[model samples]
Target chain A: MDERQLKRLLTEIAHEEIPDDMNVWHEIRQQVETANSRTTRRGFRLVRTGLLAALFVLATAVAYAVYQGLIGSDPGLDAVNQANLVTTIEETQELGGDYDWAVTLHYAYADANRITVGYTVTGAAPARDQLRPFTNTLLRDSTGRQYTWLPVGGGGGGGGGGSSDPDALVPFEDNIGASFDASIIDDAPESLDLTLTIQLAYATEDARQEFGPDVMLPAGDVTFEFTVPFIAGHRYDGPQTASASAIDMTLQDVVVAPSLTRLDLCFAAPPSDNGKPWAAFADVTVDGNVVVEDFQLLSPIVPVADSDCQQYVMPLSLVEYVESGEWTLTIAALRAPDTESPDTVIQRMRDEAGINITPLEDGGYMFSEPLPEDMTAASAALADILSEEQQTLEGPWVFQWRFE
Target chain B: MASLVERYQVHAARVAYLITQDRSQAEDVVQAAFLRAYRSIDGFDPRRPFQPWFMRIVVNQALQTVQRDRRELSLDGDRQAGDPSFMLHDPGPTLESIAEQTELKQQVRQALKALAPEERAAVVMRYYLDFTEREIAAALERPAGTVKWRLHEARKQLRTLLGETEAEEG
Candidate 1:
């Protein structure tokens, strides 16, 4: 209640410690040693390239062959990422090092616009709901130009799409497909060199249950560099229209390729909207069969030409299309964020959270009620208000595009 | 360096744990902070104390994680492990006293949870870690006025929450 009491309580909280042998000290030591050794090895490789060139050549050949066999020589586009099998380049390389994990590049799809690589990692169980934990990927060409990844709206986008089910796959196995935007390079050559470096760690069983962000089993860093050949594809531009409850959007262009299907959408909404311009396309039916079966999002609202409305450049999974059949895009919802007054937001919070928000002189609101005995109930109340603001604008906007 | 980690791991881990409320996350933050500090040990002034400097890194890492995930503070006992007081206290205590202490701890934690991450960090630095406002501003890379404002706002909320508790008691 008073200053002294508050200090004592906080100090007590600060001093709390978990009782266990799970201290990460040993792990840290191992990581430090590994890093030091890697630095030494890199130094040797750079300085003694000529001297070890022959030996390195022989070792690389053997390592590559062994690695290809470990994961399987033919990595067909299976359940991981439905990359088109016709245009996929299945190249398997073994990132041989001191890594406790094994990674095999199953297949890759590359074009002038984008590059998507599918790979499977065998190691300790991965963190649930997390993809590409400490993974760094770069695509480069002979010109020494590097391509960065475009924003993937989902949580930890570079890891591609997967089920959020915590028990979906065994912890030791993670199948991930990463898509990178190559739009930065004007005319990408027929092929580009991709260097994917990932740092992963095993999560302890307890850490898995608690889902601690920092909890790691051990430090495992590996780099895979391989050439990905691109395949050319056709582009379709249309002024297709879709509407739902005062929300309307046009499909300006769709670039269909083996690697990724990119759709450029020009969206138009009312002026008094605060949310990001997003249409939740629940499914896309091609030839009377639904092509898009998963819940994919295109958000973080990239703006179009200097307008209150925005443009969404959505890159979707590969799908089969018929030149004469009908195509229907089923939009589940059009999401526009809340742009209401602070009072309105507070009223909504009160209505949902049942908590009182009092305005401070500094123009900030504070929760004034007795702290809810049920913390979950209190957070749930606040979370409801937070979520409500995100989905302020909603509608099912369906659009159709026909090909002759 | 090993000795330094051994000596400061508990304190650094506790600081991170209080802010993030995840035991494994706290350990990770502490490890990262120590590694960062270790990498720049030459730049550190040996004349100055290391607790605040090291703790500043711990707080930053924890704040970054919270911002990235937007995780809410929880008062759930199972969510977090370790009771620093448990180590310092005698195992035997009057059952009623233990219960009362736990209830009070929970109430205080709940009230603290309501504060934003920055405000919570300010309170912890000032009252929990005993950092002066200027020192906290320096550690957090903010002006002294900002630290004071955060503390003032945090204390007001804490007062209101605890005042309501007192009224219930009366």
Candidate 2:
């Protein structure tokens, strides 16, 4: 009835007896029994029916092959493969903003899941120096959805170290070539009507001087609205179901292409019109070896129309495979948050303890907090707060399947 | 690994169940948390205590589970099945005392739910697990000031939810 009694009761309840049926050791044992033995292969089959896939590619390439020939071999357009290109939308358009920066839309490669756009930027010396667009640098489609662009040859280098006056003239003429993801235009028909817009982003003077910032300030945006016509890539529909933790998820289709390899899955989740579900396939092993280290598996879920089932696209990796190989994917493992900040917490603790904190690269702050300086006092302090906080898991919800 | 699961399964499940208030989801969260913890165990320093570290994962997993299932979650911690207070029985002739205690526990759970997930974790870690403010700050991977702020804000919200004062409860 009082605060003290209430606290006691709550603690009692928190420590309340768990049900005997609630023991998960058996399930855990089964899951961790053997990495390979635990998984039963589903729909074991070879990819693309082998010879037919090659034929389909060759057949599809017939019409576009001529267009590819017409565009010819421009070294600037080498970021995207000539074969992967579905359409050649070689139209040059100029921005009507403060500065003259022309962006030429070359071609577009689109699958059921992803679309990558190829473009080249040509501008005056000041324009080239002032503007640098990174991924999500431009918003596309009629909805103004954001698309991050990763440049070809990793060049978004509008890097200048000095912080000068806004009106300072730095004259240079250059052709900065890059490619941006136009994938934000989610549902792509045979043709895509895209409105690509890039706004001028200003970098701080302090950041420029100290960290050698890659971004510069000034200028209005260039908006280009054009229709990019392309043929839809291949999609293989195979209904396969896997269940874990009482949730049934079905692999409805798989889209294999040079641009992206995607798995289309459907599962029952509460209807959410906004934001994708946090379902991810973890510890993905392709033929017993762990690959795709740089690229994280993305599960972008959209609500299935008029149903409790929501559909999601699980992008396996950026690595494209010509043949479908046996792949093992795991779900139900919660990913850890960025632990770099925890190091900062430790550093702050060290600062409190009168120990110096040093900075490390990749957002790591080094410190041995909670350790006393002298041995006589160190024993007592060491008995408390051991300065390490890394933990791991037994395993994850795994699903093994093959393409035939 | 088996021993680790056997040792903390009950506690982890309890923490997850309390946070999610859904038995099935709590079990899934605990399972996922254990899996995550096991996978990342190589990074774990052997010197640190495992309970708080593992509990942090449990709490985070539970919060994420709740978030993903947000549409199904009710305003009062997903109590769609039945009120837990009804399950409580008076052990002695003090029927009124048992009822009051149950009512208070229910109020506490409701009040705890009103706070943000991080704040809820802070309150539970402080009161239920009997962790010091500094220990909680470490476990939650937050600054001591942040943990202190969350606790203060949680207590205020709880006080307001429990009808303004200790005098009223008494």
Candidate 3:
């Protein structure tokens, strides 16, 4: 194709049919008005200090109630609390003014490697279907070094027990709790002063689905300042080697922290015909109990820098930690990503499992019938194909470490 | 200010979409770029064309967003494998002319995805936005020679990826 043709094609690609009702200017005006109102109300705080104190006390009580509710719900935080690593913060700060939002910092856990903070928001909630409240967080150290904070796991909304149906529209509640995680300071300082700034905002259903930025509520940004003493973890550095199926593997290190366990491993596998990268998955056990229930879902295997190695960081439950005991990490299997195209995979499913999948207009497939509760036959067939497509070298490459 | 947003919002969003490959993320990038431009408008020279100055912010924002997403994905690891129930299926045939155009666009998109983000930016600025090499260099804050080299390499890669032979230079 000539440059003219390329230009035409690209120009066509660039042609986006923007909706007529997308009034970005209106949103911007709303933000500007909110900012101006906040500025004007900044001076009225001194006169309301006594009232603010009363609210603070009430908020503290509410926060304790919320904390109690969260204890048995979140296993990770429960484990951290059981390990005596959680620092409780019961103070409440009001977003104040027209936006009657109150935020309470419930608890925090920090180590040299990671940090987790939990908080609850209480106020007038937006409509469930139209709008949702979201907390945009920024974490910075005393030196003003900002770290990228992300949601620890999927469920961000809490407090209301909604329906199990995916199609159900759950109502928004006045109180909700959320937890955020970030990789904290690497160098272990005795203690570090940190500030977490959370901006409470509302997002329309469209915006949320589009991943658009949230519209800042009229309330000002809430800041929580706390000092977190760095908790250190036990690290075992080794060149431990094990071999199976003519492949040699090495365990570089293992780090056992209050929040999670990390394993650094290196190995070389024979080149596959499809040329996809190989990944090593392992089963971890602490005192004869399996630490990870599903190796494929929760464990994140990250590639080590400048080496043919992968580092797996598995989150620990309360039962996985022992004050003084042995931890065994057994490499169970090696697998590669599916190299087959989606159409091919679907065809194979139809031919082998007798599952007819219909293509939807949105490029997704729908099963001809509701899937059976027991998928043993379908799963077994897929597993057979998967084993055939990817070479799996099975080995009980075990590395044991005892920590006190 | 409203006029400026109205005039440039579609173009900016489209360019961002080409770079980020996500409609919502592209819109977010455009919104942020416009906000940034509004805050920094005092620094912009009145004599200069606003399109290039504004587009520079859009390109940079898109690139930064892409980079940040890559970092997050690396940390998060690959998402769960596609469930058979929701797997993507092949698009069937359509009207001949429309199908040809759709196929061509899909091929171009795949080729663009294969290129580096920076390379994609250079191509979008040069061919899609019709920015001259000097204009692109000024917008990107790079040397003219570097801009030319980037455009050259990007074009060569696109050509090879698209399975097209040498074409006349613009």
Among all candidates shown, the one with the greatest lDDT: 3
Tens digits of per-residue lDDT for model 2 on A21-117? 2567556544433321321111010001111222234333321111111111122223135354556677776653444555666655544445555
Ranked by TM-score, the better of candidates 1 and 3 is: 3
Clash totals in order: 8, 19, 0
The DockQ figures for the candidates are: 0.09, 0.07, 0.07
**Candidate 2, residue A315: how far the Cα is off, in Å:** 6.6
lDDT of 1 by residue, A53-82 (tens): 322342333211111111111111231243
The digit string of per-residue lDDT tens for model 3 on A188-267 reads 67776889887776555566567754232334569999987777767777878988878888998876666656566778
* Model 3, runs deviating above 4 Å: A1-75, A81-85, A96-102, A122-129, A143-154, A159-192, A205-220, A243-249, A267-279, A285-294, A297-310, A318-327, A340-397, B1-170
lDDT of 2 at A301: 22
Residue A48 shift from truth in candidate 2, angstroms: 35
User: What residue pairs clash in candidate 1, if any at all?
Assistant: A15-B84, A16-B84, A17-B82, A17-B84, A18-B82, A125-A171, A202-A217, A275-A337
Superposition-based RMSD of candidate 2 using all C-alpha atoms, in angstroms? 24.8
Which ranges in model 1 have alpha carbons more than 4 Å from their true place? A1-113, A116-149, A153-179, A183-190, A193-226, A231-237, A243-248, A256-261, A267-270, A273-311, A314-326, A331-335, A341-396, A401-404, B1-170
Worst lDDT run of 10 residues, candidate 2 chain A, spans A63-72
Per-residue lDDT of B4-95 in model 1, one digit per residue for the tens?
A: 45446777777777777667788887777765564333224333466766787778777776555553444332222123432233323322
lDDT of 2 by residue, B1-170 (tens): 44356447777887786677667887887777766664334234433467877887787778778777767765445323224442242222222344364466666666556556676777777777777999878666679998898887666555655552223455
Model 1 lDDT vs. the true structure?
A: 0.51
lDDT for each candidate structure: 0.51, 0.47, 0.56
